[model samples]
Target: MRENTEVVVVGGGYAGVMAADRLTQRDDVTVTLINPRPAFVHRVRLHQMVAGTHTAVVGYQEVLAEGVRLVTDTVTRIDAGGRAVELASGGAVRYDYLVYAVGSGSADPQVPGAAEFAYPIAGLEEAQRLLPVLAAASASAPVTVVGAGPTGIETAAELAEQGRRVTLVCGGVLGPYLHRRGRRSVAGRLAALRVTVLEGAEAKVTAVTRDAVRLADGRELPSAVTIWTAGFGVPDLARRSGLSTDALGRLLTDETLTSVDDDRVVAAGDSAAPSGLPLRMSCQMAMPLGARAADTVLSRLAGERPEPLNQSFGAQCLSLGRGSGVFQFGNRSDVAVWFHVAGRLGAKMKETVCKGIVKHLADEAQKPGGYSLHRMKGGAGRREALEAVRAEAPAIERIS
Candidate 1:
């Protein structure tokens, strides 16, 4: 009889959950998933959680496969040499393979007073913490949302729709990832909601005070509540565990998602930086990456070589409010094009996408190894981009 292979997946977000479920394809493999939260967090709808529209959480039982064991605990470190992970509570869990998917969280603003005063809505806890702060503030309070990314735009629009005064301080151009046409559509929506859009270099926030925010152009805006959605930062678990990582602290891996230091260890989601070229941190890439990571493990267990990553994207969707949205069409390379869907249709499409994501997870739970979106072709652009980087520094060492 073949021995049972033990696989431990750290983190319970989209990537971790998907990997754990897919790993159950082989009956001889026993999968265990470790996460800090008891339930699955719908990270894409975090802004909705802050705006009091959705709970942004689902019971793990609803999405995780029955064959997988869920451990509600935090992983403190990964002992690659011993093939075990140290838990925060106590003891350790041994594994034949480890999947590192401890995804991202709110980045340190680094600006003076920003961390102390601004509220970030990147994770479940962070979004939950902002709920009461928003509820306590007066309806007429001037809420300032820093950053022009999707999170900031969504939060600003959601709050503005609630009749609260909103000021969006874009450190750079508004909707930097969107085409000019899409940006115009978003600008129109924000204007209709009475949100004050501040862009350009002068709009950059320099400091945050209890009652106001200072800008780079020596202007001060009265802000009763400040929300920061600038950028995301992954946990330093990889670096702390003595594992090699990229500059942003993400576990660096080869094209097959295998750690350069140990073939038994793999990475996925926002915490993974494959070939030093990480994909954008979003649910768009996390689920596919999760499936790919599981495939790598299965291939190794079957004594076969694994394939490299080949993920593609379609569009970037953003909800302006409960009734308005914009879907910016992008090429396979994820670069925005001139085509877009705006207004009510865009809103419906955005809603469908959010619902589809949950459905995809639930469907994969029922049928292991059935997910195939990650297998789509069109990685030529990615290969070219990686080759360019490789040519620039031929001697750069691979890290994991």
Candidate 2:
């Protein structure tokens, strides 16, 4: 009997789940998905979880394909030469093809006392931990949310809508990704909610204390609770496994999502850096990348040429509490355009997007090849740009 082509996918985020489910399209392949948690985490709803508005979890039974084997465990190391992965439980699983999709976490602030005093809600557990803390706090307690990105903005709005006194410390321009009009809309909504928005160099948080946050401008704000959504950081598994990775430890891959070090390995989602240029760490790109990664593996298995990735973005959706939102439209290249939708219409659009995300995943699980996305026509240009960079850097050529 001919043995099945074994594919082991690490991580259970949007990308990993999509990749694993899509790989089930091939009858000759067996897919195994390894993750620490049994439930799928809707990271976008973590702020809702923190605010007691919604639970941020769903079961894999609803999202994962029937053929994909689910393993509730953690991967400690990847042995490329031996084609095996060492599990924390003292065993190893060999694979013919490996998908590296371990996603991101809250970045360490590296500020004095920040780690000990501040709360991070990047993951499910972190959000769960913050829920009770918020519930126990006084109604008028001063709450500070660090960072002005989507996570920070959503967190502050959710809490403020619940009658908490919320302060948003932007540390820089508010909504750096938003266009002027979009930013104005967001600021207006925030102001209407009675939430204070602080920006510029002076708003940059330098340190966190037990009951206050000190800023670079030498101003201290009384923060009964400090929520840090400043930035995200991926796991160091790729770097530790001796794989070629970017400075942030994302596994480096070609446009086809194949790892630079070994053709048998592929990467997807936030953990993947393709041709040294990674997309923003968001689910907006994860599912498509995951499907693309699976296609690359299927092509290799069938001895066919794989196509390069052609990625594009259309909008950046932000939920400002339950009844309000901002859907800032963007060009194909992900640059924010002047057009946007705000108020209840934007909120409905945001709600549709959140539901559509899960629906896409579920649909992919049922019909892998049916899923499709907008493709950019800049593949050759990207390769040329990478070549130019390699010529100047020399060492980059080896990875390219």
Candidate 3:
């Protein structure tokens, strides 16, 4: 690469922002960040925004740190072999280190009319667009949310609590991660809110019109707003660039979050699929991935051995409605157990976590370079392993 210490970060979400902020600590490094939107969207608040309890559109102009360049353009192509990035506006960016965190996009199912009719709540823009649809419908109008994952559950709970008719169509179990108690609590909360949940029924949303949802079972459910919060699929950047990836299109990375076949490139956030474990697509993994990526990058620059990838989240906090949720405690793997929290207290914690996430970005932007060189507090044992990392060395391929 032309620039010895230049860094290019793709996307501006939690993972991208964290990477940018951490890179600023490297006094000798310059970071160039690219994303489609000018502002960073708080993805966690999307459900609240759709519930009509919050009207503000969250952003991150104030969250980015100084010395970090923010480019408001989409990345069209990544030439990994040449260490370059092509933007939609017709220009290319060259870099010595690249942190790919383009993140996952809304997964549209292959059902007949789902693509044409349903609105997903995965991004800020999507939630904003669904507001008008919810507002125009009456209180008793049926609002179906397809998918019973965290996003689906949260969206359904938030709206149902507002006295709107809400239905959650989950093809599988209510929550595959929840323990018996947590599952029961969630079910109770939904029932108390008068929400109808459909489980085990194949929800093939054949069509989405303004007034109804046609299913593959030859049933048409009356719906004013059909919100789909099903699954996540990463952007096609990694696979298109001829990189190693899983079947889900997620870039396959080694233990230390580096691209399996290219040490020059590191993957983070939902877009990164690490070997040995199933990583959940959430801010929980994204934050640590960013910090670890920064450490790996600085370790190479510092001429130290690099660390392998390792992360664990022993808990899951899900907001049931405004000021209410369930905090399912678990081990490193997300097998939620009996110990949990409920009601307003749990909701407050969720809110605090989201706010803290935003404030963290702002802090990183304000203090770049001054601390980017420092390694994270943990992982001291891996210092020697990081020493072998050369700036341009190829990665050891490991697929999930």
Report residue 378 deviation for candidate 3 (angstroms). Answer: 11
TM-score of each: 0.98, 0.96, 0.88
Q: Note the Cα lDDT for every prediction shown.
A: 0.92, 0.90, 0.78
Clashing pairs in 2: none
Order of candidate numbers by lDDT, starting with the best: 1, 2, 3
User: Candidate 2 residues 97-171, lDDT tens each?
Assistant: 999999999998999989999999999989888878888899999999999999999999988998999999999
lDDT of 1 by residue, 1-400 (tens): 9999999999999999999999999999999999998999999898888888999999998899999999999999999999999999999999999999999999999999999999989989888888888899999989999999999999999889989899999989999999999999999999999999999999999999988999999999999999999999999999999987999999988888888778899999999998888998989999999999999999999988798888898889999989999999998888899999999999999999999988888889999888899998754678898889888975233222
Question: Which has the greatest lDDT?
Answer: 1
Clashes in each model (backbone N, CA, C under 3 Å)?
0, 0, 25
| CA error at residue 193 for candidate 2, angstroms | 0.5
Q: Which residue ranges in model 1 land beyond 4 Å of their true spot?
A: 394-400
